[model samples]
Target: MERTGGETLLSLTIMSEYSETSSTETFSTFTGLGATSGKLIKRVGTVVVNGVDAILIRRRLNQLEATLGVWSYSTTDSEYVKSLYNDLLELSRPVYKPPIRLRALRLIMGRIEMMRFEDLATAVANWPISYSYGLLKTMILCFRDTLPLIDMSVGIERTEALVAYHYTGSHRAQKPEHCAAFLSWLGLTTSLSTPVFSRVLLQLDILSFVTEIYPTDDHLLRPSAIRFPRQRLLNALLIGLEPVNDAVLINQVHRIRTIFVWARFLNPPI
Candidate 1:
């Protein structure tokens, strides 16, 4: 069937959109049947592909947003959540512009914030260590956009669990890269003036805090080789500790001092 160029182009465009939508549906099926059945199916085809040809990407994002909106916190499925996390991570990669990538990240954090506390912990615990770390890095990169999406009103237990799961490796052995990323995330989150941020800091176990700071090896300990901001970390801790009582504040300060003193002695220049 010979056709004009415009007609051919239009046909190809329609086919591309259909293919991309089909791919998304196929991906969803492997994650779980009926996980995205009702409202999700309705929202799947609404995003119009523009000149950017980001139809698939935008469709995936829309699907995730819709899923999260309809997601059941009480009967949450860990594998289903993990699949969503994986998709959000893929969308947050460099292939997308900062806006799109950050939006994906924001959604990732939003999903974390939206989960029931127990489900949040279990889901994070079951996730691959690398996947958890990737999620941490996404939050770090989109600090401002993602931080407030976390519902601090969920109370200290959930907030601490969220931090511990991603940052401290509550379910797995901690990696240097994970620790580095955690500090970056903590540094940013603690910079806020709210007392809730302070309370979140206090909820952390001193052991996890020390482990992150203790410098696992020479690469991490070297003065010139430190990967995270030492002074800023100290400042964040101080800012966070400000709202605590004198006795508790004193204890935290002393604990922080022990690590920093050792760090400074090892790296005398700082």
Candidate 2:
């Protein structure tokens, strides 16, 4: 979806004429011939109305009227003024509604909170691909503070969850940095013991997947080649392995390093 920072509500140049016929006035009330007296307060200024500006301007005008007892009226030739009432009605109508994805995630998270470990795994496996990353991220963050308190049996479920989470990154619309950040958070928070770590790496086949997706020399050579950031993913992988002190895990880390070296050799420096 296309996103914008802000919207313009209205824009116009306003002209005002004030009557200065009050007896309290100390100065000349009329410059031109009139029954009482009048003063022209013509302001040639463009006012771009946005959020809260309309309300602020109205308040300022009201304050001026109350304090100085000066009665004034303004006119704008802009066609927008013709439908100002309708425009205000439109603005008054509610426009904020949560995205479908967010609502779905909230429901899923609620379901997950009451589920057994096996059921959680099943849910993760069956989760719609579009929102899998969101669900996984939410799960990780929810349990982050109480990782140590979690039962060991939940490790298997977490491993399955991670595997499912990894595949979510393959979605075309998925942001690489988001996936990378998720992995980094997982590594930093949860202590991925040998069995769980090994299962996640092997089940996901992360090494092979990374090799397949990493932009190769030929791809880089093409002028039209679309390169997305992979450095963050690589770093995330290394960080995820930081808690593993096993000799086998160390060898796996070295292999990952070798792949990095090969990738650097194939692709030219930016």
**Top candidate by lDDT:** 1
* Total clashes in model 1, counting residue pairs 3 or more apart in sequence or in different chains: 0
Off by over 4 Å in 2: 1-202, 217-245
Looking at model 1, residue 205 earns an lDDT score of 43
- TM-scores vs. true structure, each candidate: 0.35, 0.28
Give lDDT tens digits, candidate 2, residues 27-83.
532212221111111111122323333333333333322322212214343332222
In candidate 1, list every pair of residues with a backbone clash: none
Return the top candidate by TM-score: 1
Q: What is the lDDT of candidate 1?
A: 0.46
Worst 10 residues of 2 by lDDT: 36-45
Alpha-carbon local distance difference test for all models: 0.46, 0.34
